[model samples]
Structure formats: structure tokens, C-alpha cells
Target: MLYQPDTYKIEQDLSRFGRTGNDTFIPGATEEGLRQYRRLLRNNINNTMVQAFPISRQVLPDDEWNELINLFFANHDAKTTQIWKLPAEFVTFVKEKDYATLWGKPWLNDLLYFEWIEIEVYTMPDIEAEPFTLQGDIRNGTIVVNLEYRLIPLRYPVHLYAVEEAKNHPGDYFMMVYRHPETREVLFADLSALDTFTFENIAHEQLSLSDIAAGLKLQFALSDQHPLLINMIAFVQEMMAQKLFLGYAVERKEQF
Candidate 1:
């Protein structure tokens, strides 16, 4: 077999690019090779643009389009003054900086992450907690929330845009994303219905499902015919099958 210098050089360039741990294009790389590498890099970046920048749907002029792509995927070097090796640059940036805001409006990064969480919650081999109906004297004034649940705060609220009533408006909002032991999917609940005091009450385990229903009497009903009740039952069964629900809510008096 003939030794191919071209193939050898390509591999050498790749190895140099990979092992160097720097964003500068592999040294000794020719302009022609660099152009081919950059073309491929740009193609990959274009595919990522939709999720990264939904706003890119608008047609852009060639120069601006190229500039945004470069800013996202390329790293500049002051010495040789070349921009290349986007994968390395992207990885470095993701690790070193909060680069998520480039995708859209300021808070969209957390929205995207929250959206991704549902997929992640659905697919994991471990079973997720399902919604369950409260039993044994879940009455008016009972405050209900998951005992082991976590708020999972972002720097800003990402769920505000999701509220149908707030469709025309934009502001900060926190979400109570939870998975009861029996449910296969995560649930997203807006925390804005409750006052800051109520939110604090839930965190302190001072509220019960019964109490929450009374507080928002019209929003949710406690009857067995309620949609939430049916969903909770089915979810509880699923969680039991998966061993995901432990059925722990704060005991009313114990909450105080």
C-alpha cells in the first residue's frame, strides 16, 4: 500500500487541533484545508442555530449571518489572528461562561433548560414520582405540596411566558416543577397564584393540599371526580409500579 501524505496530514492536523487544547487552528494547516474545516464547522453551527436562536428565522444578510455564527462558534487569536475550531471554543465557553442567553430573550435559556428537563425526566431509567390524591382528612385549610420537592431556582423565572393569562405580558415567574412518585411525566405549576407568604408557607411546610384548595377554591376541587384526583390515582399506581412514590406530605399539626 502506498503511504498517503494527504491522509497523514489530515490526521496530523486533527490530532494537533485536538491535543493542543487551544482554539487556534492546528498550526502548519494550509488555507485550503482550513477553509474546508471551517465550512463543515459552519454547517454544524447552522443546524444548532434553531435551538440556540429561534430568532434566526428571519432572513439575514450574508455578512451578519456569518458574523453571528462566528461569534458563537469561533475563538479569536490576537497573534496569528485566525478564528477556528468551534467545537473546542464552544466547549471552553460553555464551561467558563453563562453562554445560554444568546439563544433568545434574556430568560429563554432557563426556559430551554426547563423544557429539556421534561424530556430528561421522561427518559431516565429511574422512575419519577407521580401525582397522587390526598387521603385521610385532606380538608379545607390543608396546605398541599411535595415534601421532598425542590424549587430548582434559576437566576430568573422561566415559566412566566407559559402562563396563558400572561400571554400578552412578560415578567418574572417561578415554576413549581415536580414529579410525584406515580407519574411518568414531570408537572409544571406556576407559583404566582400564591402570595409570597403562601409560597413561603409551602416551603416551610405550613400549608396543606386542603388549605390550598380552599385558598383557590374555584381553581381546584377536592372531589373524587376532579381531574386532578383521577390523574393522581393513575399516577400513584404508576409510581407504585416503578417504586417512585413514598407518599410523604407534611402532617397538618407537624407543619407548625
Candidate 2:
């Protein structure tokens, strides 16, 4: 139905209820109305948040989760008309406020951020790409990594902290979230420091694999008086197989 006077009033009432949980101003709205609205809205909003931040949700207790939901409903006045984005707004709200009272989990926000980015990567639109060759000279030819990839150097191993192995092991980590161009499937890689160094060199501008290897050796890719060419080659091959390395370009030599 289009926004008529009565419907507009009802919308206003619900908006108010969304932020206050009180519907006394709503004409003929009873306590039952408040109860039902609160339940439905809270459930839907919480579900969205969970879908966006699954790791964080699983770690929180029921009461703590409910508090987080209530806090968002009462505090957030979202700018987006789209309900799908409420979870992101909730994350923003948490960033501004102190949710430590709910739990002393210091890693919660970082984990939430990582999980949220997975959803974002999954839903992000793929751009039209020109055809390219994945096989080329790694030593000199320009290389192109997939445009769909984001190299997130996370402060925590939030990508794998849900597992038991990462329980005791913690350090600087890179969470590589990307989507396959052909399949549209979202994939993630918890990269090593060396992998991060190599990945940083592949760009849309096209840097050669050898140049990347050289840069790494000059900076940190060396091991016991020699550059780790073997490791670099293996990593490059894996990335190519995984479709992370789109292809390479050989610039023609200038004619005199």
C-alpha cells in the first residue's frame, strides 16, 4: 500500500517502537502489539547480524546476544532504507560504544569484522574483465592477480581462531578473502608472512613475478644467502591453480 495518512502514522509508530519498544502512541496498539513487534523485529535483526557475524555470535551467550540486539534497536537510527544493512550499522554502533559489559571478550570485534567481510565479499558485484593469459614469464613479464581479492592483514587470526589449533598459536595474520570470477564462489586463505609479501607485489598495474621475487629478496624474502625462489615458485603455482593469479602480460621490446 502507498503511504496514506493512516499508514504513515503507523510507520511512525513502528519506527518509534523500533527505537523505544513503547507503542503507547500507536492508536489501538496494545501491550500485545509491543510484545509481538519487539519479538519479530529483534529476531530478524539478530538473525541478520548473526548471518553477517557468525563467528562472534557463536562465541557469545544467549543473554549477551540479546543485550547486543536490544542495544542496536534502542540506539541505532539507520540511514540506509535497506534492512539488509542493519548488521553493518550494528557493528558501527558497537565500535562507538562500550559493549564490554556484555563480555570481556576482547577479540569479539575483530572476529565480527572478519566474518562480516566474508559476507561482503560474497555479495560484491564482479566487474567485467578482459581476457588474459595465466602462463607467462615470472622473471620479467607483468603479472596480474585476481581483481576480486582483498589482502586483509588482521591483528588476530580471526579466520581460524574458531578451531583448536589456533587456540594457543596467535600472531600477525593475513586473511585473504576473494571470489572466483567464473564460479562466483567466495574463497579464503590464511596467508603466511612470505605469501603476504609476494601477494603485495601482484597488482592491477601488472608487476613481473621475478620483480616481485627480487623485491622480496631485497626486503625479506631471502633465506641463508639465497632468495627463496623455490618457495616463491611453488606459491605462484598454487595461486595460479586456485585462479588467484589471473594471468600475465609480456610487454613488447621497443623497436629502434
Tens-digit per-residue lDDT, 43-127, candidate 1: 7565555343343224334665565456555453313222322223333343244444453334434544555444444444553
- Residues 1-256 of candidate 2 have per-residue lDDT tens digits of 5889988988887877866676356777677867787778777887888778776777778788878888888877777787776666776787677573345555556676677677777777776444577667766666666777667766556677563344355578888888887898888887788777777766643555666666666776465423565676677778878877777754556999
Clashing pairs in 2: 134-247, 138-210
Instruction: Candidate 1: give its CA RMSD in angstroms.
Output: 11.3
lDDT of 1 at 239: 36
Instruction: TM-score each candidate.
Output: 0.40, 0.80
Q: What's model 2's lDDT at 146?
A: 76
Q: Cα lDDT for residue 206, model 2?
A: 55
lDDT of all predictions, in order shown?
Answer: 0.45, 0.71
- List runs of model 1 lying over 4 Å from the truth: 1-32, 45-69, 75-134, 139-170, 178-183, 193-256
